[model samples]
Target: MSDASINASTVTTQTRVNEASFGDYFSLLKPRVMSLVVFTALVGLLAAPVPVHPFVGFCAILFIAIGGGASGALNMWWDADIDKVMKRTKGRPIPSGKVEAGEAMALGLALSGLSVIMLGLATNWFAGAFLGFTIFFYVVVYTMWLKRSTPQNIVIGGAAGAFPPVIGWVAATGSMTLEPWLMFALTFMWTPPHFWALALFMRSDYDDAGVPMLTVTHGRRATRWHILVYTALLALLAVGTAFSGIGGPIYLTVAVVMNALFLRGAWQIARRTEDDSEADNYKVERSFFKLSLLYLFLHFGAILAEALLKPYGLGGWS
Candidate 1:
């Protein structure tokens, strides 16, 4: 190659390297997942017995969202290799070459520190400590360790996602309570089935990435059975929580209706033969996954509505 051609090629490559847009940085934060975190945290904060000042509540959520984003950045930094292999994750900032791995790591650590410190100052040390632990749990326990090592990774590692509501509760009340734990339980039990349903249809992604997802390690039949079992348990927890302090008639109605449909979906998935799945292109699995999204959001939304109705004396049963 000529010297000028080589220089131009190098310049083009360098330009590409330095051309990351705002969306690239935002993508590192995993905005979709962060939205769920923000909504659940807001529900927890609102449901707490103690009321937080509007500005303080806003600050708590902002820092919590930042902490969630930091965890995502760190996860992308570490999982860039596996991400490149997985079709669903190959478009992430690092794997797509839109952002450097080192840049992601630095952004993660910096944001982690800033979010925790600012949360402590804005709310209390208890909430700040929870946020710190949540970030550590997600980045270290789930991403670095369990995710590659075990098929049960989502089951246990789900605790990281489950912590947001508790952190929000503590931020508002400055203490722990059973209500927050109930909310935690709702998310915890829901994770395995939710992810497993995705794994059912996206089995190739996990297999390609060499992640030991239950669908990859245990076969689709076993994964389907596991989904049914967990879905039943999740239904029980969701219904039972309707009697808790956070629950009301609206929540109960949502729980009953959603769980019925969710259980039916689980049953369909559990009974599907391999031939049936292949014939339909795993449509049932895909539908179930979509329903699971609405399942959790509607449940949390009911909780938020109950909170909104509390001051008017219409939250729970009289």
Candidate 2:
């Protein structure tokens, strides 16, 4: 059999062996991550200070979510080999043999074309083009290239995730703005700390897969220091957004307190040593990881609240 045929046969055999389910295939899209993408993109669309038609707004966010999902599917397809080796990812659709890599690639590509075209038709060309670039960057640049090649993968590739707010803004205004770039910077700065926390605990998985995650290539001490530095920078950016009119007093308060806690956690992680056992050290890392998720969501949620409370004219447009 040819290599393609052999791969197909392997998937088939694994499916029969594991009795994988439909949810397995859906998991390829990384729905949890996509939900956050959708929510943040929606907030950006709604809070843009410029009004968009409700239906158009819905369609814009929908296409952006679809584009994010397409990126996830394509990532799984391309990273199947590494996914199979990583404990955190071994159960993913392609790796678990619930979805063929070819099937995933096709779905991802179809979604990519459909989302971009529909977004353009529904909203504007600017949003569609942005969505197209986000998909391409995530799948081709991040997953296929930077992921395996460099430790700076997340640093650069974080742009894919960061684009949604800007795209949402463009969908409404037909142009870019400083407000959306602030949002983008928030996510970009947050990515390293958020992901490095996971990497601290999951370093062995990347090592086994030969993926050049910072923790795998550099020592854990360096990874921890990087996380601390990025967390501090992320905090600065988050608070800075508040002063930029996209945020208000509520957001500023939340940003300050939340970032203080985040900073302390990062400091604790940095001060930890490799000699510490996984069970002991992982507590701080995992706590920071969970808090990191909440950090972004709550910040954006505060922005949404500020936008809604237009009575006080708190978010700048008086």
Candidate 3:
């Protein structure tokens, strides 16, 4: 190639990169999602029967958050083209033209490597391996393949989110057990209802993106039914965990009431319709969405409370 042509191409690339925006970089971190990951992972570390060094726990959680962020960045990069057309994601880093896809990809890859390696050095091999799997699963499996291909994306992709607690537990114990897996199960089961609710209301956005969400492919009514079913299952699995070794009186009590209310909300969503013009059936979907957030936060909070009240034997199972 001519030197003039090569230089022109290089300059064009540099100019494009120079135009990247700060919020675009922040979007790569998936700050909204990272908050929950940090919270749940911290609770898992604290609730574990085994105790860990303070510094070690801190390091483990930090690295896990970074790994989660790395996955988010990579996901945005891979999904950017479709994101530009989706109402919900059009403002994201890549779609918004604030960050180049290649730049986000580089950042994600760097963080993925660093988070896993540092986690292994700071904590244990198990924690690092789990983190590595999470990044790969979310990036390679969910984002690259499942997301655009199936309505079951959230179901299988949910595993990536569920791993944080298990990773936290492993960081503390240097191993895994039924209790941590139960916590993992709780999050895994909760994911569908939580995400599907958003999908129901944001149906147009997904259609624009050409993403095959259940709502887009299966119809809103079917999506609503799935949401209710998953919610019920989540409630059952969550409350039932109270019977497991990880659960105590406080956790059980919280789970029962929370799950009951959650079930009621799901039922309401299932019964309502977008055709009903009175209350805007979307309101039902939105309400369920808000409650779903609380359902998870409160459940984990109960676990944290149980761990704290162990000294007085107040929160332990009777």
Candidate 4:
């Protein structure tokens, strides 16, 4: 193209980018993801054996939420190019032309530094540093590197999301222990199956975007088998956590019921032929995807319930 056309194109892109409003900026932070981070972190904080000051606890959660937002912003900025092509992500702020890539990077960097420094001051440096590391892992390691490089991206990258609970535990007790790692493992192990279920139904998006999701690289059959395998392993861990002191009768019951249902869902997905799946338009896969959300939530909810009832001598293993 001529210099004039190039210049015009740049200006048009810039103008649209500059028109970003408050809501557009907010969308860059990935609010749905922020909610999950907040909920899981809150559970970790409350489930700790030590008590946290109310104000301090609130601040820790706030900063953690901000850090989670920072990661989302940076992720959007980096993934904007790919986001434009994928049906699932085409409407994101940067991809939709509502927010500038530079603006996203700036907001992400600002929030990352602010949240880390404030968290350290509000709680302890350890928790602060963990939050900082989580951001780095998500933005630099997972988003920039692993995402395009391999299908195991989400597998290894899931660690970034799993760290929140451990950070929350540290923020509350000023140290780490076995119990928080159980929470971490719960989310960590749960990540693969949860996401693989999504990849099953959303296969086209990954293929179109050239993303190396399990379904795209490993074939849907391999992906289904993977889901079933992970779900089985996840079931064993979930039920065993009940005997791990952090879980009680309530958690045990929830674990047994949920994991059983979860495994059955995985099995159904695994047993389906491509034709079988197409017959109902991936109904079982979609159900499993929805159920996966409820599955993690209820597990954490059960843990929270156990912790809340602990003071009343009504929670945990007797």
Best by TM-score: 1
Question: Against the true structure, candidate 2 has what lDDT?
Answer: 0.87
RMSD of each: 1.8, 4.4, 3.7, 3.7
Cα lDDT, model 1, residue 212: 96
Cα deviation in Å at residue 94, candidate 1? 0.8
What are the runs in model 2 whose C-alpha is more than 4 Å off? Answer: 1-22, 277-281, 311-318
Question: Candidate 1 lDDT, tens digit per residue, 136-169?
Answer: 9999999999999999999999999999999999
Please give the ranking of all candidate structures by lDDT, highest first, separated by commas. Answer: 1, 4, 3, 2
Per-residue lDDT tens digits for candidate 4, residues 231-306, read: 9999999999998868999999999999999999999999999899989999999999999899989999999999
State the RMSD for candidate 1: 1.8
Per-residue lDDT of model 3, residues 1-318, tens digit only: 999999999999977875666765866989989988998899889888888889989999999999999999999889888988988888787886778799999999999999999999998898899899989999999999899899999999999999899999888888888988999999999999999988877758888888889988998888878988998888889989988877888888899998998888788878877775135757877888898898899999988888788867787685
Using lDDT as the measure, the top candidate is 1
Candidate 4 positional error at 30, Å: 0.6
Task: State how far residue 220 of model 1 sits from its true place (Å).
Answer: 1.0
Instruction: Give the winner by TM-score: 1 or 4.
Output: 1
**Model 2: per-residue lDDT, tens digit, 168-233?**
988998888799899889888988999999988775888899989898888788999999999888
Q: Model 1, clash count?
A: 0
CA shift at 287, candidate 3, in angstroms?
0.8
